[model samples]
Target: MANASARANSVTVENQDVALLKSTTVGRGPISDIAVDGDTVVTTNFGDDSIAVLDSDTLAVHGGVFAGQPTTVAVVGDRAFAAVSSASYDAIAVIDTVSGEVVKEYPLSFNVTAVVTSADGKRVYAGRSGEEGVDVAVLDVTAERVGTIYVAKAADATIDAMCLDTTGRRLYVGVTDSRSSRLITVDVETSRVRRTLEVGAPIRGLALGMEGVAYVLTSDIADGGVLYVVDLVNNKITADVAVAAAPTQLVLSADGTRAYVVDYDHVAVVDTEKRAIVAEVSVGARPSAIALGSDRLYVADYDGGVTVYTVAASTPMLYSQFASALAVPAPRELQPAV
Candidate 1:
């Protein structure tokens, strides 16, 4: 009977293809960011000022909370941190993922553009950019504002996107300059600028990969676009690959072997080791953000809708079982615990 059970399990797994996973509309509005933690998928809606929580295994919208023009969202343990824009509240709202309620809101001196949590999930770094100045505020979740790092030279720079390395010791900030885009590396503990590398054109999105490697998507929004590979150790551009027109966002795979770039109306896969284009998947319409799960790639398109792609070494297939499995019953009441 044990052997028969093992055989049946193998057959069930064989029939489960990654491609079978359908991309469901977990929430409305333009998704600014999508983060997956265990079985939960949290998406920031820039259009509706809310954060939608979906079950990764079922693709069902478990619940959502009004987060106020949330431009970026990051999950560390049970807490979900959202960077609300100045147009809304100019603050970072903390939501409890388990209860789907706003537990705290940290008001910023300026517009908060991005928020990233530390590796150990003890602290959060919020980036504020506007007429006031470009600064990164460090928040101790257990306490309050412990310190603030001001990018004096970047006062005129528009801080757009930010990402941290695996160690959480280093942070890469994407700043838009008058003529080009600058990738600035900051020491998280010291909160000081370590290095600045310039990309010829303005960057719309940036992503950091393993081993101190950074990828920048140059979006001139007029002429064309390009992708620059930067080596953090040497603080230089190792390679530059020209991409499709108006590339918006860049996402790296889990292994850091490849990078997925969203252009005007398509998604291009780049081989990071070789620094070359490997596969160009036509997504149609403008793609907003790209996220990668265990073996699937999720693309949030501007108009065409979200698309999920199956990625694997052998016999790649999209699985939709997770989407349907996400329909857990909502709680009777969602209220602030504190």
Candidate 2:
């Protein structure tokens, strides 16, 4: 078993080659979502139900806190909110970054699959997976209270992925199933569904861009996957770009010109404006999630570990800018509330 402070094994690939800078081992369990603040990297270890805080530059374990089956996490200022699930119950554990201790735990009825905080860190939105389709759980960080919001009403479909708009006033949710998928938009203040667009394919991940544009990723077991660009203003799908098989997640570049996609065994760099695949980088067996820093891309692998990739300076963009404008962390499960 791996401990919280265990040393990480580092590996380096060429700078322009695949964007890989180093790979770090966070003990021996499955890793989920990751969040980055100035010099700290926070990760959730699902297998151990613990949170590991690492030195961003050295990738060394700095501190950790044990939460029960933590599946996702979001950071705001000096705090981190982690969604944890146990056999009998589910909760969100609040951790104080300065002390590395769990300060509070907000109980929930369903398992949380996705979590994101407002830019000011005043509010948090958690997505839950269940048959009832009660997708979103709104949390007031200052008040320590929570409320529920339903993105999808059907009993069969669940929330697959989530991201907040640039203003943080609107939230985009992907509701998907084997047979169909839909994009649901919600007004943050009222916790009400604003618009529901029927996106035909099965959604795997989601990302947003300029002028109310949303990039939706859908996978077909027999035919690989596709990236769809939807114009929210017009409420229609405008473009479709083909990608590799099993595209798990999407992260837009700071300028909104490129999108980095992580699939089963590789990461595909897509030129958003061109609607084409520009680069493909090989990775571990099961790359579950990804997080973008100022100049790096952090990939969480279930079997291999966490790999840090350098974002070429020539790209002329930062992940944090892109993350701040759209989304940062990836989805945790197939039917995600986030």
lDDT of 1 by residue, 45-106 (tens): 77767787766666667777976678777886678888776554577788888888888887
TM-score of each: 0.80, 0.85
Against the true structure, whose TM-score is highest? 2
- What local lDDT score does residue 338 receive in model 2, on the 0 to 100 scale? 28
CA deviation > 4 Å runs, candidate 1: 1-20, 86-88, 221-223, 282-285, 303-305, 313-338
Q: What tens digits encode model 2's per-residue C-alpha lDDT throughout 1-338?
A: 22222423333333253445666777567787787766777889876778988777778777888778887888877888898988888988888877788887888877677788877676688888776665788777666667677777666776778888766778899888656899989886666788988888788788877767899998877667899999999889999988878887777765677677878877777878878887766554467777766677777777526777677433423333444454323222222222
Q: How close is candidate 1 to the true structure, as a TM-score?
A: 0.80
Superposed model 2: Cα runs more than 4 Å off: 1-18, 313-338
RMSD list, candidates in order? 10.7, 6.0
CA shift of 232, model 2, Å: 1.3
